[model samples]
Target: MIKAAESVGIRAEWVTCQNAGQLMKCDALFIHGTSSINHHTYRMARWAERERLAVMGDPQSIIRCTNKVYLAEILERAKIDTPATIVVPRGNAD
Candidate 1:
């Protein structure tokens, strides 16, 4: 991936993206997925939003695939109840 970037004269910087400090160095993020990230990464994503850098590709594809709650929300919104759900802490969140 870095090689492909270098081919186009674009410099790729790899850093420990724990927050805006990391994303602040880049102009954009072509996020292929979010399966490998933890909660801290979400904070970085929020920072990216605040910083106004472009985040490409389907973030949900990785996020929802890794997070059960998020995936459930997508399914529910699509009216596709693919899982047997029982929300113990179900409240008037909606």
Candidate 2:
């Protein structure tokens, strides 16, 4: 993503929750690897929000996209192809 941005003449850098301080100086924030709402990315996203910096995948987007059920529903509504999916109850680990 950074490479693609650089190609377009937008200098981009990857930062993490550990370097959130550095993010405050950036013009924009494009978070990656936010696998779950509980992940550190959420904290960074929230921080970005407070700072009012533009985020590539906004916090709400992160929340919905990180959950398979919500993402599948969104894809279905958009008529986007996705692998067959099922939502199992939390206790049914098997």
Candidate 3:
């Protein structure tokens, strides 16, 4: 991904949790790892959004997409066909 970006004249660098502060210096963020609300990736996404940097997998998306029930509802509301699904509420899976 870095090579492709640089080939097109777009600068891209890898940022890890240890050096996430570098996000402030980037014009965009492309999270290349799993994102969870309890994870640093989510924090990074939120920070990038607050800084107004283009962010793929933005915080809101991470929140909504991470919840299977919510994602199902969205797909249903949008009339997008999906495989048959059943949502088992917490503690009700017996």
Q: Which 10 consecutive positions of candidate 1 have the poorest summed lDDT? A: 32-41
Q: Encode model 3's per-residue lDDT on 9-91: one tens digit a residue.
A: 99999988899999989999999888999999999999999999999989999999899999999899999999997899899
Per residue, candidate 1 scores C-alpha lDDT tens digits across 1-94 of 7789999999876544534366767888665334344654555555565678776533444465776777777788899957587444557556
How would you encode candidate 2's per-residue C-alpha lDDT over 2-75 as one tens digit per residue? 89999999988878766768986887788767446788888787778878999777788877877788888889
Computed on alpha carbons, the lDDT of every model, listed in order, comes to: 0.62, 0.80, 0.93
Candidate 3, residue 53: Cα displacement in angstroms equals 1.3
Which structure among the candidates has the greatest lDDT? 3
Measured by TM-score, how close is model 1 to the native structure? Answer: 0.50
Ten-residue region with minimum lDDT total, candidate 2: 28-37
Residue 8 error for model 2, in Å?
3.4
Clashes of 1: 0
Candidate 3 residue runs with Cα over 4 Å from true position: none
lDDT of 3: 0.93
